[model samples]
Target: MARSATTIRRSTLTVPVAPLGPENPLPPLLPRDDPHRIDPRQRATLPPDMARQVGYAPLTSVLPTRLRDGYGRDRVPTDLDTIVLENDRLSVTVLPAYGGRVYAMRHKPTGRDLLYTNPVIQPADFALNGAWFSGGIEWNIGATGHTTLSCAPLHAAVLDGPGGAPMLRLWEWERLRDLPFQVDLWLPEGSDFLYAGVRLRNPHDGTVPVYWWSNIAVPETRHGRVLVPADEGWHFGYEHSLTRIPFPEWRGADRSYPLHGDFPADYFYEVPAGSRKWIAAVDRDGDGLVQTSTATLRGRKLFVWGAGPGGRRWQRWLTEDGAPGYAEIQAGLARTQLEHVPLAAGGEVSWVECYGPMDADPTVVHGPDWAAARAHAEKRLAATLPEATVDAAYLAWLPLADRDPDDVLHTGSGWGALEVARGGYALPGTPYDPATLGPDQRPWLTLLDTGRFPEEEAAPERPPGPSLVGGPWRERLECAPGGPLTDYHLGVAQWHAGDRAQARRSWERSLSAAPSPWTARCLALAEAWGGHPQRAIAVSLAAAKRALATQGVDPVALAALARDMIPVLLDAGRADIARRVFDRLPQDVRARGRFRLLDARILLALGDREGARAVFDAGFEVADLREGDEILSTTWALLTDDPLPAAYEFRMRPA
Candidate 1:
């Protein structure tokens, strides 16, 4: 089969494992307290004041069996195990045993702020059956309150449809000790018009409540506006209580001092129990808005915090030394790995909150086509998904970020520092002053634009291909003025350099500036790079379809490209989505025999031995036909089921 002529047909390819949840060691839940650093030098960095303000305790502390009993610390309790909750609004499982806790917890104590905590087991010195375990403490109730407990170690918190079916987000981990198992839970299952969740499982499992507060740093611009519901709330306290601000809400408390900057903050609103209201911090000038909640918890309560842009608390912990923009749904946990709760022995905790979109001007929705916003999000989400084995490929890619020769591109340590390449793709890249791209770079830029360059010049004096961009790559993306190629290159470069924020921005801009099948591929890779495989799969399929209609491209080539991404996508928690996309492809595309070897590798994901054999058979028959490097290598490995062949090749081109 001619590789270029082969069409891609959707086919079912089951991912053996779910996407890997956030598993690496994130920054400590505590605030950054580098006394040696100074403002701008240390400005916007996580402050010591923020660290001291919030309480974070690891579960590693010897929890006398008594407290353990309260939190189901002993054997996984049967009550919390193997139970599934289903209803019209939502479907979920709560498994207390086998390291599976609540998938979605929604029942809030009469007067408690919605708080979700993971009950994890600190394994004994000697491994039990050579196993280490952890689980989630979550609850999901529909609008009517039907619930279930899933004990399958792989299933954790998931967002069913906004108003439809349940989407499973399983929380799982390998048997690695000394790493905190964490899980995130959104207080409200499906609230208002938006969905958000916070992963709060930290490795430490310290005794502290680990109260994390979110300060939505929304930006106001000339053409943008912030949107949030207009509702009443009580000022609980400043996110970082140490930040000096107006103390109108503080009765007799001494307010922290030396307030600076132009934007003055007012209150820390505390939403009371039974209050179903949501708030939004909007930038009328820029059209940016953050709809969030602020609540204070005493004993096992969830504390949700927020601050306006440029406010003390917002700038303190959120602002990084190199990157100043800060707007995220944050929590006070190191990872999403939760401790394994022993059956019904652990204390049961529930969180309740709602999310809604507020109209900044109420007429903005009517001002322009309101559908545009929804369409934008849907399109973006669609562009972020992949097909077939792409998810698995994504799952495999997550760990590689840690092992990446340029770890600064994808690790938390490299959150913001990175650069984009000329293709509008985010990849491991180096920061070069545009002014530096002189005659020497013309050859490279020409190749980047036309996808062709002299073979002789291809081998540059730099560190081989794509590695000589920078030394000690940045931890974030550093933006500069440039065109589509510049932005694209910058995005990929930042990703390669390990700056997620920069990568996200550059790729988003790349797609907007030039929405094409290639841009879709770039978006999918970026999502996979960020550890979101499901989204990656979705976008890949859309891109394939778009390419089919617009570019008259071969589907098998698309599948082959998609298949290249399966490992990383799987790592990002989109196994189901990836499988769905693969299954949806046309059958002719599957039998094209072009990506046949690659498809055979996908069989390993689906547990199809016959499929594996078929690929090998074809490989043997076509031994004389020169095959692409990826196809030849993948086929050889799948046929023999050996690890060695799979390891070799693919060093020259990125998946």
Candidate 2:
């Protein structure tokens, strides 16, 4: 056998470690009258009188607020000096202030940091709710995607396990769903790897959908390649839809290699039915990192932005310009980014993943030869200390005995408690003023009653209504503040009732609260109907951009946004723009049978009646056009110079 390049040895010395740097404080809240104030439309569903009485703040305010000591303080740095773990070959720093994220990790042998470290600790409106920072290993738990708790502080401690092995432990209570999770980062003696063991416990009496994904970022390099042991995997794209494609090969390109100036792509791959549980990324220098976990960590994902202008802009936004942009190598508990694992109430799920450095020839990195590459990588990994040893070290260091159920500081309500729990006093020297909540104020009551309390008063019962549209539904929505969908329905009712102004207002409010493709399309239609066709086109484009920027991972939203824009663009007499929008839509969505009429319309608008007929025929062969039957029939009659029916004129009505 060839001599191993590096040998493992045991050591007994106090590891030299310290806080990596000063904490990066969360930005102070903008003044109430600030131009960027959370939109009133978001609060449109709330009863006006109650909204004023309780002084309800938007959900974004609770995010990025400290859960522990720094609560309510403006500019509280998230990087508190707490604990660091280091060995001869590696060093790891944990930030107790910033959701206990592993701030940075360095492989001593190569003097290279395996993880990307953002130079500034700035928060942006990037998370699902709002406010997130880029870089480091982000621990996400809750419903799928980046969880709400990703940026808040988590309970953290330094533990001594068997043989005095030091491990850094971080945990947080997912108060939104009442789940408790803990992560342990262990760098054992003389080992060149960092081992992580995660445990999620459901304390409720009923099962809940739980999502957990560890997002690891590394610098993007020209020769970078990601290796996952699979021949075929599920490809997730616009609208969260899935298509199985040959591994690492997408659209006739070897996606495992770095992409230069291509459209942005987010793909998740389900491990082949009997593949090993490991993924690795090799850089240009042939030095790389390998991450191996148990079968429970089933999903492997790659999120990339090709070296295109749009991709470069995102890179600059995430990091400073001139710095190499990074890519995410994510590990998830489910099969895809949108899929959530079902955890039984009172059940426990635990798994361990190992990260270590690897050196290999760059030629074997990118693959249609995944089997050969995987075999070589496996052989290299087999020479290291047994995985069981790392698992034992983690189990011994888990701080289960120290966990507190009432330790709810990592939640939205936990941030609220920082003020209300302390005699209802607001943060000192800050602009925030706690509302003098009354028994019937649902917003204030909900905030105060989170965690350990039960509600003191029930919401007033809404009057029974015959229809969700029109006056009765509008009145109910006004009284209780339904979310975006309810407001959207109200807008539709207003439009049909010839109250165009009110409809526009309702749609604007709906978009402000949650910018979804459906809501944007409705807003555009409402604008066009109200005689602002240019504004309608502009808003449609803005909505598509926002959907791509903030909710890029949502393929369904992207597809819907693209599909809805076709009609809006055509309505605005911008057939050229409509063509561009149509071209950008995912082939899967554009090829769907339901979109055939839309395809035909676009062709007709472009003066391609012959092509339109062909596309229409193809679409009809695959899809039953029940509601759309009239549009197609009329278009065909017109094409053949046949007599048109009275209903043909209805096609000219507002779509």
Candidate 3:
């Protein structure tokens, strides 16, 4: 009997799991008299109506839960409990435990994994909110960066599509934003490609930005090359300057080629005009993987850590020694992950993406020569079998006598699966009972209050306090002395309390520990507010330079710091220094509405009234000038020696 091109089977394999490691202890839960607390005046600045609408809360009221170590010594599972979907061309393994990640995908013909797989399941403090792991195809939805649900398990079920074709369905709730989404993954019979359909739903009345990115990691080697159909790309760095550069060539080297030097590079590329809808990575041997999605998915990104010492250090931190360092080929729903589109209340958006293997000629070294690879991809895409139409009505079917309560299985209409142990799954139209389900099938409600859940409720409720002068925030900081997050929060409290010196110290200490552009920006702001303009300029400039030179720093944070520095430097009567910093900024940053006014001011101060007017005129066409339009208009009028635009606005303080 001949084997089918694609088949779905449930099986288990013993996989290594690391024990929970040491806990990072939290501070006390009581408020105390301290300078590092939010001031009454600052608290009053928050509009009551706005706060009520957004469910705003204070930092002091939120108590930290006991930390659990997710990374410890490794141990393998005794049971084999995994689902495998494969075709003659490729194989995919799905793990329900690791947030339903596509644990491994292999190109069967070459016996190599199309996606990188960690040797052991080791969770670490890598997530922006904490608890993340490397490798595999991670589905990020809702907020930007890694989704809070990245480390949690998801509701999963196996279902049959039209004509009884096998499919796996995984769904989870975006608790923070009150959004729900589902991903259906299928490998059609006799097909070489695996397809994913993502459906996102917003049920609330308030509009919110929707962010989704599929992060795929692959083995990084000198011979590996990432190929995107785009001819040119937009690159944003730590300084948050969005520079347009020719594709493949960034800085000096061809970035499409795998990491060869000693630094990390992160580049987000927009879809080029008339480009095909796919991105791929091919090795020196010409064996590679390709991912294609609908035109709705607009962004392609490449993240690589070169073979330098810094890159190697990060490699060791992310994985065990000897484990291969990998690069990521990510796809985003917008032009960049930082840019999100609005999802209107009660709205829905969905799209489909396909993944498979491609064989290319080893001799194709450059972008121009990638025609062979593209042709190979086109053939595979053209050969993709049509998916059977899935029936939606069968999703509510009752369990069969022999079926495990936790096992998600296909019904004729839809899928039948157990609810997650932690309660967040509110199936839009489908309802289920928690009391009738077993422990594994029941919702885990306790996790919600413990801050382990990703919902907004995990944040602390507002506590009644005029200021942190007699608040619990001080005790919390005392308890968690070395935590960078704690220190940053403490600095915020100090800044609001009019203790600028202490705030500067706290921010500096936080930066020393975590080295984030965010903390550095805060420190610069503290210095400027504390009447030290020179120190503020120095701090902001140093931070910006460091961010530009270093890898792994968030470009958004860097951009904010650089943008804020212009106003601070100009206020300090140092337009020359401001111009220097502004010149280093990416063209996109300079083109911002706020920066246009600053640019005109700098030119005006340099005795170039005509240049300033030209910039202001250009700003009207290109910038989204909002709050400071009147200020810019007045500056322009004064530059032209026209009649004063308005009475001089001034404030006076008693002597």
Candidate 4:
């Protein structure tokens, strides 16, 4: 017979005796026969060769150190063991059974360092052995193969320190369309990888159906928020609506959940398809946030979005306010993408995404001279970004991220939480805040409190604007604080692409007349967005100065507002200006919060994973707002390359 040889697993160190003959194997192997013969007195005996080997032979007598330690105790043989390798900057563990597990561990000795994670392989609760392959390469089989790989430049992984400890892990697995997908796991000695993944084979023939998704989890907490980028286009098989992105009716009707209830079924955000994507959620305090994207991957198109509370079939792993939160990338219905490797008899596909942790919001890029950095990145991506994909996809697909602004308020009367009209008041304590509008506007608060807009009563010519009920309502409102409530209308329009110059003018005038910090800040933002950087800076600085001048602006509110402004500032190229503001920030504002959602975004932009992870660790608390369900749409948009913003507008006439 040709010399037979035993296949050795290079990744492991076990030496198994192989190619033994059936007759005289190492020791006479026992079979299910000849245990006790019909003669009761006869007993089975070891074969002569086995007995000789067992009698104090060097191979038989030598035992592992662990066995020596537990010599007298009852124990089973240790089939597998892992050891951790601690170097100056990393800690890696190796497992005997799985080769190398827990591959990389990096510490940001000075600033935040970044690292990438390999895709997880979760097998059944027990089994755990998988191979890993890494590096940048393109295969030539599928229709879109090579062209797709050339679509985008690669983004490196980031590392950050979460509060001086290890918290976040990032991995960038970039892939393009029309390519055979191959992912392999690598195991080094002495490490046991935490999660086990199972590989599945595709059953589809070569028709080339596209599908796959990623599941990513973060620590969850009560104060978490999600942000997504916006876009404009119609690449996905759906239309956009003002309140909801319309999925094909055939896709099935989507349900709604209370903004403060459970996690949604499927979160989707509507952003412009195929455009520069950026979105995030900030902890109320602005300390942390996580930003991510795959738009830079060759041949891969990316959409922006997130999740809301309760709307889909599965319960969210996040506590309405708990630890360990997560965001996922999905393809098809949840069932379609799980371990599904589909291709023709020999076809395959691969996908990749990049995630960055930020200690602050991306909007606040001014302070650090990131212009050069931004320019460098932009130039690199521009060289390879596919013309076919740029700006082609707009709108976000985050359902949970798109809840109606009105849904936020509800002061329950006997009527329960109900929708009031534009400029309406609630029963009170409804998920929405009442203080948001001026008092004059409260009377006009959608009359649902009693009825629809009340008919006008005849009276001597009254000044423009609103009037309340009973006892000289007009005079009381005129005397009572904050200027005319017209700012609300202007604020809403400012949020849209309306005239920010005019809007800022209106909001500023009103704030000056009434003097509310919120109004002042809003007016400032409008000015900034409308090409009035100096004025915008002045406005916010004034508030900060005033607060400093007048007993420090409510530190908490100031911090919250500042955090919110970070992204806006970054987007507008006001990083330098924002730096000034950051320096003057209150001591309390600088203190860490429960979750640093905003911080993650900032860290991501700066490519500091260690810092980003720190913020994410603190910002893990995501509240269980029914609004979470709204995020599913965004999630869908990101995973499926669909572009549509939440609130697809359709001209409507009262039926």
Candidate 5:
């Protein structure tokens, strides 16, 4: 047997990355704007204890993290910074610059990639920040949706581990929850499994909501089966509700098979406590990947895009025409991704997760008897890597969790440094280095050092910079002298804290001082939420007018504003106004795929069905089309009375 010690090395991964264009220059107008997400339905079905924690420490806004929807289909070869940890049996590739994603894991014995490795970097509107790519194992740590860190970087460093071995640590301060978390990865010589010790800590004086999920994507196979130690699971479908469904076979289809269903869905398995907590996606030969973790990580799930046309189209759109489809088998702290667990002040939770290939007897593993199949998996897992080993790994890592990172590999966002600067936090293994602070954090740092929020003119050409929605920032903004920038940002922080009335007042003051479009957009959102539709409409129109008045404005910025404004107008039955907004754009901008989508929408509303159909006939593609966005097919249905085009069909749920 080979005796190569666990080693960490700097590496480069060359893949095709569709460039993520500049962020929308507009501050998010909606107070809790989340048009890209699906709200979990049927809360009444949740038990009493589970219901109490669903909205724990919920985020009122995704402030500071701007949307990244400005990407196109064009791809170019790019080399990304990566950290690789390898031993005799396994080699793991981590992309520190891209959300610390475990980009690839090659099992040496089988010579196979355990996780679905995306062939290219294709940005889609699936994450909280508006851009995400499929494949690899991604650590989701912020909220119920795809994390704001999906495309963001993380601080990485090499650290000494047990017995002179080396471990790779990825750490970051999650801005939304205002908490710090870290993941340590290492592999032992001759061992088949890779180990990850994760911890999330809240240093504040009050409780905060925390959500974590290790999402592992595997190839979707016709004969693949996902097994969990549960008899019944909660099924969440786009039908807008959660229904109780039994495991293995549900509704005459084997739910464990990733391709058995007809629509995209989530099965939150009811893993009874004290049972061996594990999940695996295995082929017909009963050889594939298996994941097991310590007791703190209780939830197990299987997410699949079923065999439906929309599902098939989405599978193709995310990668390429002939790329194989994949499904996600995930584990989280709670029973489902829909809920968050609360961590008290000065409290933290830590656990260890293990991943490796599961090789079991095909007959028993894929047999109809559920208990026998589960027994086979658990038995093999215990023999291969016992829960005791995982527990010991967690215990050993706890003592070393506070050690300073020995060798800095890559630098992430400076938000952590700003947090540490404000609170004097003593986070250890995850150093929030002050050196990482860049232009974005300078304004906030000034507010912390000096006693005032810096002043800046609110104009379309120079929109508001990054926002800090933490409580301390809000308090400082309150005490600072009134100014357009100060008060406008204060309103956003206040709104994120759920103080709607006070937030509106702050915005009102900002608008009174400077009639800027960004502030007007916020005021419009407030009116819309307050049931004042007419007032909302008036403010929205003013925002558009203010935006259009600026000279030498960025076209991409204008496109974002128009995209958001047109939808609001159309939704409110003001397509004439929507048309007005669309017609004002430059001809080249209008010809862009995303705008052309709006063009078709507006044409349909004006009873020009032929024109709307003509837009589709011209064959334009929505470059940043969101996941599950059915507008193209719906518009086609309403206008042409013809079969939906294959290019436009991206429905993820059943008809």
Candidate 6:
């Protein structure tokens, strides 16, 4: 592992991209917004500080970050902007426009891909903003789960790196916490490792809760084994519980292998203090990817989708036919992703990460004795890329962290530009150029400068636009001239800040000003999350009716609303009204897979089992199916004793 010559070049990666169709016009909301959110069962087992961080800055709302759930299943060949960093032994391709992900890392000597290069780009209902695809080395920042920037772009530039090689730096203003973060990646000459230096900075005047996870997806196989330093881990699943579990083997089976179990779960390795942090996924042949980071990223994890039908279905859904399954080996700032550590005012945390190939003895790694297996892998890691080298690389990259961009490689969201204009920040390395601001930020820019939200000429399809939930924006809205649009946006900002009572009042006043669907839906969400299900049902129904009555309304917007509201009615046993809502939908709108699925629920509620079964027999595909969604299987089971078809068999549990 000696330094040699390196190369950096800009290129395009053309793949079949299931185009992210559009931003859902509706502001996304949840049934409940839990502040200080963590599993109650975990309190006794966790350290107080880690428990506190888990509840810290629980993302109450995703206002400014609009939902990107509008992607479809159809894919077309698309060219994504990419930056290729090559050395004598390694080649790394980073997608500048797509969440600054390392799309592929090839070990030139073996001609191997060290990370899961998802054969296709298929967005699904994952990320905090709803559209997340599975693959690559994804830099997850903001709150827990996938970052809002998963499918979004990042500002990219080139700067001097180690050995005077060109470094690719991606930075942007993360809107949720109103923070700035940057990722600097480079290949040091002939070294096989790809080094990435990540920095998350809190620019605010007060403490802000921050989360960062470097998620690296590797190909999963029956013979694959994940090696981590820890002998114990915190296991979490869709069951909403976290429990202490021994490493490698859980219960009887060795959960280290992806196929050992049949349900998706997370095993967050409890790496002992002073241990060198690293995780690897090695196959039977002992050829695999290894990710190790400097001390700041103390947590390592193994996320498996498992061998269940749901997991398999999702695996195929995200990639092309015949592509292998993938599992994520992640490194983070906390023991588990459920926590968000607090970053002090004007404070910053930076660390370097190394990703490349590792060679191990397959027998010991896949052995029955967990301790020996783990120790053998650790020894190999220590020899391959010593802990000292990772630390040294981090230290060397620190001084060059703030070097201004010498060449702008790609443009990202204008939200950063707007933030720059508001704070007059002198962010050197990641310049938020004013010229990047576009129509999306124009209204907010107007609100910031003039304390007035620019309104469009009245139109049915023009619901209240996207929201700005920053404290400063909320204060500006509270002072702005009150109108339906202004008050509605103000309520959204308040809700995001965990001020439910104030948000409710603002929306009420907005609804009184103009009984619009947008304002009504916000108020209903407040009611639901406040434990007033009956009131919520009524308010949501009213909102749906209001939208239905409005002319020139975008059909897509109306469909999104019904898709959200009908479930509430059905959950409350008000299927009669839910049926009314469905009957009112335009034929084409009701024909979408999501609605047709809802239609089956209505039929089942009406005691028409045959009708429900017939709907399934007709065949359809839900493009935005969630990660653990088993509703199709549940509905199918309810319909009859017949086996659920392959297309509809996404049941992760043993039903």
In candidate 6, stretches whose alpha carbon ends up further than 4 angstroms from where it belongs are 1-4, 31-38, 456-458, 528-542, 641-643
Collision pairs in model 5: none
Per-model TM-score, in order, reads 0.24, 0.54, 0.56, 0.27, 0.96, 0.94
Could you give candidate 6's per-residue lDDT for residues 199-281 as a string of tens digits? Answer: 98876789998999999999888788899888889888776677889877778988889788887888998899888889889
Local accuracy of candidate 3 as per-residue lDDT tens digits, 426-456: 4542223343344321112322233221122
Please give, for residues 1-655, the per-residue lDDT of candidate 2 as tens digits. 3322221122222222221222212111111111112234533443354234223222222222221111111233333453567777787766665566666778987898888776545454344433455677888886544555656666555554335565555665564344567776677666788888788876555776677788887778887887777767654432223456786666877877656326455566757656657777778666777787766787788777666544554565444447777787888876655545668866878788888787776666554487787677766666774545545654664543233332222222232332233334322111112342233233323323441122122111111111123243344444554455556656655654557688778778866776655566667765765689899898877765555555233554455456556777888888777777777666876776546667777778888888877774453421222211245456666455654322232121112
lDDT of 1 by residue, 307-393 (tens): 323232223222223332322222112111111111121122222222222323434421344334323322322233212222232
Candidate 2, residue 28: lDDT: 13
lDDT of 5 by residue, 53-148 (tens): 664555566776777877888889999888999998999999897799999999987898999999998988888767889999999998877888
Better of 1 and 4 by TM-score: 4
Tens-place lDDT digits, model 4, residues 1-655: 3422211121322222111111110110011111011221211132233222222111111000001010111123232332333323333333322212332322323232122222221111000000111111111121211111111111111111111211112111121122122211222111111111111122223433333332233222244433333221111211111122332111242111112223222333344445443333334343322323334321211121223312222222211212223332222111211111234544323222222233443343212333332333333333433223222211111111112222111111111111123223321111223333443344445343443333242111111222222122222322334333544333323333244455566566666555555555566656665677666666766654444444434444555456545655655566555555555776645544311344444554555656654543443322211111233233223333444222211111110
Candidate 4, superposed: residue stretches over 4 Å from native: 1-502, 511-516, 528-535, 547-549, 552-556, 576-595, 603-610, 613-655
Q: Which wins on lDDT, candidate 1 or candidate 3?
A: 3
RMSD of 6: 2.6
Q: Show where candidate 3 strays beyond 4 Å.
A: 1-7, 20-81, 237-242, 365-655
For the record, the alpha-carbon RMSD of candidate 5 to the native fold, in angstroms, is 2.1
Per-residue lDDT of 159 in model 1: 35
Least accurate 10 contiguous residues by lDDT in model 2: 458-467
Quick one: ranking by TM-score, best first? Answer: 5, 6, 3, 2, 4, 1
Candidate 4 lDDT at 280 equals 32
Query: Which is the better candidate, 1 or 3, if ranked by TM-score?
Result: 3
Top TM-score: which candidate number?
A: 5
